[model samples]
Target: MVAIIKTGHSIRAMLNYNENKIKQGKAECIGQGNFPVDADRLTYIMKLNRLEKQCKLNENVKRNTVHISLNFDPSEASLPKEKLLEIAGSYMEKIGFGDQPYLIYKHNDAGHPHIHITTINVQENGKRIVMHNIGKDKSEPARKEIEQAFNLVKAEHQKKKEFKPEPVSVRVQYGKTETKNAIENGLNFVVNNYKFTSLPELNAVLKLYNIEADKGNENSRVAKHSGLLYHALNGKGTRVGVPIKASRFHDKPTLKKLEKKFVANEIKRQTDKSRIKNAIDNVLLRNNIIILPQLVKQLKKEGIDTVLRQNAKGLVYGATFVDHKTKSVFNGSGIGKEYSAKELRDKCGANLEKLKGEFQKAYSRDDLLNMIKEDRGLLSIDDITKIVDLLSKTESTFDYLNKDFLKQRRRKRHRRGN
Candidate 1:
C-alpha cells in the first residue's frame, strides 16, 4: 500500500487534494523525510488560496488562512481519524496551533487512503515552523514515520482479510495530452506495470528532455500509446522522462534497461502471490478448525483431522490425518495430489479470488454469464456459477454478488406478485 502525506487548508481541502500525485509521484512537495523508507513525512505546502486569503505573506494577500499543510498515510492499525488526531496533537504539543490552526482532516475523496494537516506557519508559542527545502525537510522524517505506522496496519489488515486492496485499473488525468499519454504509456511500458500518478513530474522531466509536450489531438510524431512512463534516473540521480511507446519503442536501450531492473521485482511479486495462495489453501484444508466449532464433529466423523503448518516451501499447508498417527500425503494421482495445498492455493485459488472479485463487480450478469458460458478461453460456465453461488453465501458479498441477477430476481418477484 502507498502512504502519502501532505498538508492543505480546511481538512476537507486536504482530503480533496489531488489523488494523482499520491500514486504517480507527479505533483510532489518534497519534504524532510527519508526516501523510500517506511516513515511519516511532513510538508508545509504554502496554500495559494490561504496565502491570498491572509495578506500575511505579501501585501497583496487578502485574509488569514491556512499557511501550512502536512499529509501522510498511516498504517491501518492507526485509523485515519486516529492518525489525523495524532498529527494534530503532535504539532500542538510541539508548538501549539497557531491563530489560524491546522486540522488533521480525514480524506476519502481521493482513491488512496490519505489525510491532510493544515496549520499556520506561526505557532502560538512565538516559534515558527519553517518550510525547508521546499518543505522536503519536514516531509522526509514525517513520511518515514507515517509509512512505518501504516505498514503495520496493512499487515494486520492482510491477516484479517480486510485490507483495502488497490484497484487493478486506475485512471490518471493530465492537464496536457502529451504529458498524459507520456505518463500512461511510458510508465506501463517501462515498468511493465500499470498504476496511476506522476503526470506533473513526468511533464517536468519531459520538459528537461525537450520532449515537446502539448495538450492536443495529433497522432503524428508519437501521439498516443499504451504502457507506463518511468523517470529515467541518470547516474547523477537526475530524472529523465522515458516514454515507452509500446510496440514502437520496444527496441530502446532504456526500456530494455528498466525491463532488466524490474524483472526481479515482478518475480518477487509473483512469488509473494504464490506464497499467499498456499497459505489460504492451508486455512481451507484445516476443516477441523471450524469457525462454528460444530463442524469439528462432522470432520472427525469423516476420519479427517485437518492440521495446518507453514510448509518448507514458504507457504501455509495442511493435510488430512485419519488417526493421531496416520497422516495423509500426496498419492500423485489427481489434482492437488502432486503439489501441496499451498501450491494449489497459489496456482488456482488465489487467481480465483481475483477473478471472483472482478466477476462480482461485473456490471451485468448476462455479460458475466456469457463470458463464463462462452469460456472465452478462461473459465467454464459451471465453474463460474459455482464461484458465484459460493460468493452469495459469504458475508462480504458486495464485491462478489451478481448484481444483475439480484436485480432481475427482484423484478421477477415484483411481476409475479402483481
Candidate 2:
C-alpha cells in the first residue's frame, strides 16, 4: 500500500472535496472514526461541526486539518469495503489518530482502490498534536506493520507493478459530466496543488481542464459585492454552462478566499520562478527565432504549459507558464521582460525576413516537395501549409530551415563582426 498525508488549515475544504466526490458517484463514505453517529446516518453539518468544534479548541493551530489517502495496488481492486474500513481503522490507531474523529471515504475514481481519511489534529483538551514529520516517523512504520500483519502487497513490491493509477481529476468534457461536479473537481485539484499568484495565473492552469473562475465587469453588482463565479468552458474556450456562484460550492471558493490564497501563493511560488525562466531561456537559445506556437510546444516537452492571452482582435497581449513539474504558474512579465508577450513576439518576428532568405537558399521547390513527402507525419499543419505556399510562390518560403545550419551561420557572422 502507498500512503500519502497532507495537512491544511481548512477542514471544511477537505470534507467538501471528498463529499463532492460522493455526490458525483465517484466515492462513498464507508466509515467514521470516534464519532457518535455512523457514517451513513451523519449529515454534512454533523461532519463539519464535529471537526470544526475540535479545531476551535486551539485557535493557535493553523494547520489543524489532516487528510490522508491510503492507496492499494490495482491487483487489490476487489478488496471489500468492510476490509478496507478495517485497514483504515488499524492504520489510524497505529498512527495515534484512533481517538480523533475522522471520516473515511472509499474513492472509485482512480485505477487503484483507495480511501481518504479526513480528521483534525487538535485534541479535546485544546492542545495540538505533534504532526512534525508524522508521515515519516509514524505513518511509514504503521504502513509497513499493516502490510505484514494483513499479508497485503508490500509498498516496495507494488512499485514494480505494470499498472499506474490515473489522476483523480481529468479535463472537463462538455455535456459528459455534471457541470458543477466537473468544475468543482478542477477547482479542487488546481486550488490545492498549483501555486498561482493571481486570478489569471489560476485560470491559466484551470484552462488546461476547461474551467475558469470569473469576476464580472468592474461596474457589475457581483464585482461590487466581491462575488466570483466558476463556469465550464467548451472546446472553443467559450463559456457554455450556467455560471455557478462560488458560494454554492461547499468549500466556498469566494473572492475573499482566493485573495488570501493569492497572497500565500505569491510567497510559495517565488523559488520556482527561476526554473521556469531558465526553461524558456534554454528553448530560446536553441533556435535563432521561434514563434509562440513552437515555443509553447517546446516548453510542453519540459513539462511546462504556456497559455497565451489574446484580445478580440487576436493580438497576443500576455503569456502565462504553468510548470507541471514544479506545480508553479508564472506570468511572462512576472519572470522577465524578454519573456513578455510583446518581447517574445518581437524576437520571433525579428529574423523572419532573414529566416525566409535562409530557407530559399537551403532548399529548392523539388527538394521541398520531397522533404514534405518524407516528413509528412512529423510536420505540423502549419508547416505543411507553409511548404505548400512556398511551392506555389517561389518568393514565399517556410520557416523550415535547418536549425544546425542556422546556428553555424550565426557563429560565422559573429566571428566576422568581431
Candidate 3:
C-alpha cells in the first residue's frame, strides 16, 4: 500500500473533485467517518456542510483541508469495498485524521485499485491538527503496518517492479472510443507521468499515443485568448476529430495550468539531461560514420525516441528526444550544442570528410570501385555513394585509365575514318 497525503485550502473543491468523478461513473462514495448518517445516504451538501462546519471553527487555518489516497496493488483489486473502507479507516486513524469528518471514495480510474479520503485538519474546538511532515512522520509507519496486516503487496516491492504507462496498452483509435474519454486518458497518462518543459516537448510525447495539444494559429482567437485544445490524430498524424477544449477535461489542463507545469518540469528535467546526451554521444562514438537515420535507429534501441524537426525545404533545424526509460523529454539544444540538429549534421559531415581523406590516401578511383564491387555486402548504400562521389571528383583520371573509355574512343575514330 502507498499512501499519498495532500493538503489544500478548499474542502469544497476536494469534495467536488471526488463528486464529479462519481457523476462521471469513475468513482463512488463508499464510506464516511464521524458523520451522523451512513455513507450511502449522505447527500453532497450534507458531506460538504459537515466538513465546512468543522472548518468554520478555525478560520485561521488556511490550509485546513486534507485529501489522501490509499493506493493498493493490482493484485488486490478483488478486495471487497467493505475491506477497502476498513483499510481507509485504519490508515486515517494511524495518520491522525480518523476522528475528523471525512469521506472515502473508491476511484476506478487508474490501473490499480485506490480510494481517496477527504477530510479536514481543523477540529470542532477551533484547533488545527499538526500537519508538519505528516507523511514521513505518520503515514510511512502507517503504510507498512497496513501492508503487513492486510497481507498486501509491499510498497517497496512494488517500487522494484517496472512501471509501464497506461497509454502504452491502448492508443486512441478514432471512432473506437468517445473522443473526450480517449483524450482524457491520454492526457492523464502523459501530463502526470512525463517531464516535459515546453509545449512542443509535451507534444513530442503526446504524439506517440495519437493525441495532440494545440493552441491554434497565432492570429486565431484561441491563441489570442491563450486557450488550448486537444485533438485526436489519425494514423497519418492529421487532425481527425473535433478538438476538445482543455478546460472541458477534469484536471483542466488549460494553457495556464500547462505553463505552470512547464516551469516546474524545467527544474525537474535537469537531472535527466545527461542521460539523453550520453545516449546520443555513445551512438556517435560507436559508429564513426553515421547519418541521422542510423543515429535515430540506434537511440530507439536504447529506449529513446528522436524527433527531428524540419523546415518546408526539408532542412532539419531542431531535434527533440523522448527517453522512455526516464519518462523525460529534452530538446537537442537543451542538452548541449553538439546534440542540436545543425551540430549533429556537421558531425556526420565531418565523418564523411574523414572517410574521404582515408579513401584518397589508400586507393585510386578504379581500385575503390573494384573493392566496392567485390565486397558490396560489407558497405552500406551511403558508403557506396561516398565512393562514387570520390570517383566523380577524379572523373578525367578515371576515364584516362579505363578500358571501356579506350574502346569507346577507338570506335569513334574508326567511325569518323569510314
By lDDT, the better pick of 1 and 3 is 3
Q: In candidate 2, what residue range of length 10 has the lowest lDDT sum?
A: 160-169
Ranking by TM-score: 3, 2, 1
The C-alpha stretches of model 2 lying farther than 4 A from their native spots are: 1-24, 35-76, 110-112, 119-177, 219-221, 361-392, 395-418
For residue 235, give model 3's deviation from the true position in Å.
3.3
lDDT by residue (1-418, candidate 1, tens digit) is 2222323333223323432434454333322111222123433343333323333443322222333333323334245455455554544443323244433444443323444444445433444444345334444444445446544333223321121222112222223343433443333222322211223322322322223222223553333432333333333334444433433222222323334544454343332233323433454466422221122234444433333333444233432222211212111111135344344334444445454445444324554445344432233333455556655545555545578978998999999999
User: Per-residue CA lDDT of candidate 2, range 145-217, in tens?
Assistant: 9998877899888842223322213354444445566676568668877898888999998888777889988
Residue 55, candidate 2: Cα error in Å is 8.1
- How high is each candidate's TM-score? 0.26, 0.70, 0.72
What are the per-model C-alpha RMSD values against the true structure?
Answer: 19.4, 9.0, 9.3
- Please list the C-alpha lDDT of all candidates, in the order they appear: 0.36, 0.80, 0.79
Candidate 1 regions with alpha-carbon error over 4 angstroms: 1-54, 57-83, 91-100, 109-112, 120-129, 134-137, 142-213, 217-418
After superposition, the stretches of candidate 3 with alpha carbons farther than 4 Å from their true spots are 6-13, 58-65, 127-137, 159-165, 168-178, 216-227, 348-418
Candidate 3 lDDT over 271-339, as tens digits, reads 999999999889988876665666777899998998777665445678899998788999998899878
What TM-score number comes out for model 1?
0.26
Best by lDDT: 2
